[model samples]
Target: MIGDMHPGDILGEYHEEVIQLYGLGPRKVLVTEREAPYPDGRLIVSRTDTDGIITHVNRSFVEMSGYTEAELVGAPHSILRHPDMPRAAFKDLWETIEAGKIWQGYVKNLRKDGGFYWVKATVIPNVRNGEIVGYTSVRRKPDRRKVEECIPLYASMKAKEEEEVAQ
Candidate 1:
């Protein structure tokens, strides 16, 4: 349900500068509505430094992201962030994990090939010596029903973000 491919193919391709994201810098990225079916029963996992730079990724992560392990490692995990996602969601996530707590939510992920997918993501801080060293994320398939529930919630949150930015 979560990974079901949508009919959104590369029907349109355009470039825009994105500057609102916290970590990922302003740049042009390909956008598409195409959905890449999530590979069932496979878990996508990755580890990132305190700076959010990726340090390792599982094969499942590499495959799901349409990025090779080489391409993913050392890159910011936000590289896969979808613009439709509300900035508030990530803000909450970062605040949670930075407080050494686990954060879980449904995420819309963007693929290298301009396709998209969804995941039930769980993220935790990697702490050592009384300090946070890095973070690890484990994602799995999400319930389709839950994905539907989140759609409007996220849309409203994104609308709020847009309104705030406009002010």
Candidate 2:
């Protein structure tokens, strides 16, 4: 499945430098105390290759991410990863989606301007001709109650990850 999806198919017009930048840049950026306001009825969508390079994004995704179309198209999805999000959560998400399964979770995403927002996200593998070519993700404004419930769980997971890394 991974072989079926060529980087050129997902990375149209972008050069290898773009992919290298994704793998080399600062994994975490400025973190602001402010939060990005999420309005109701908005959905953010994006598509990425198996390697997680963003291929396409909807208007909502651009607006919510506080990044322009040009900025996001060639960047890794992790450009919006919030520090509060645990690495283990992403590990699980990648594992699930790579296995051709749908992965859903509450995600706290960082905006380009250093603000943050929470979303209920569902990521599905895009299979063509019996092989996965890419992935599609749909995110909507998260329920406040669910966000509250996940806060402690994610915090605990983050701590565990830190402990393991320290060991």
Candidate 3:
């Protein structure tokens, strides 16, 4: 179903609706620079439930993922998942978050066109009154050499995780 989308389709639709609703742009930005730590190169941010269902995404996230707010909301976070990414890596990420900590790593994401890009991602668990509620992620362009080194290791880990899951 995700393959059925084209780049800019989602963004275009959101632009129209937003312009119509607020005359231009959002009524108020949900995630602002004052609230976030990273302010370099348009930080991409997304919020997801514990089940990975996307709840909110910022303008940068929409622009980078090539998906509109309507399409992204309520969708699985994996909508942007790259096939080459290893399951074990995600498992580790989940473990880190579930343990009440943050997970920081590089990620390879697939665009609507099947092209891929790399990001340095920081995923944090959203907690309320000592209980985990959801997750929030901030991503930015990653260093090329770090990505290159990670790819092969991710592939091997993916293979291993798949083998283990299969059994």
Candidate 4:
């Protein structure tokens, strides 16, 4: 909720910019340019409903994402999507998981403080009674080489997406 501000607001204007996130309905997020380094030797884990609402998160997820358990539980997993991430990456993830297959990839995630972090994410379908009910994602420190390699590729994909949108 974008709210009215009171006096002595240190973060006043720049932090308020929000966007209706993709595939996450109308939920919005503030974005920033800062990058947060992933902690070494820590793995972040989370689970989400089929519609992508967060169901569970590990302590590392909570600490790294800067979101409390109460704040994260009912939120869309896309709440953590960084704007720098190209939509095509998520599109492929969804396609792979929806087909009941595991998908592993490098990803950039957004934190509640408007900062970003990179991770190597493995998403698995939670299946029961021959049906996939939800997804569980385990994320670890992404290889620096892969993260560096993806930067320009993702930028190109984002640019192509924007070009298509402007058509």
Best by lDDT: 1
- Whose TM-score is greatest here? 1
Better of 1 and 4 by TM-score: 1
Question: Which 10 consecutive positions of candidate 2 have the poorest summed lDDT?
Answer: 11-20
The residue pairs found clashing in candidate 1 are 3-38
The predicted structure with the larger TM-score, 2 or 3, is 2
In model 4, state the lDDT of residue 27. Answer: 43
Please give, for residues 56-162, the per-residue lDDT of candidate 2 as tens digits: 99999998887788888877788777778887788889999999999999999877666679999999999999999999999988889999999999999988977
- What does the lDDT come to for candidate 1? 0.82
For residues 1-167, write the lDDT of model 4, one tens digit per residue. Answer: 22222223222233544444665444445666677899999989999999888999999999988878988898878877777788889989999999999999999997777677999999999999999999999999988999999999999998898899789
The collision pairs in model 2 are: none
Off by over 4 Å in 3: 1-40, 162-167
Error of 3 at 127 (Å): 1.4
Best to worst by lDDT, what's the order? 1, 4, 2, 3
TM-score of each: 0.88, 0.83, 0.72, 0.86
Clashes of 3: 0
Runs of candidate 2 with Cα error greater than 4 angstroms are 1-28
Question: What's the TM for model 4?
Answer: 0.86
> Which scores better on TM-score, 3 or 4?
4
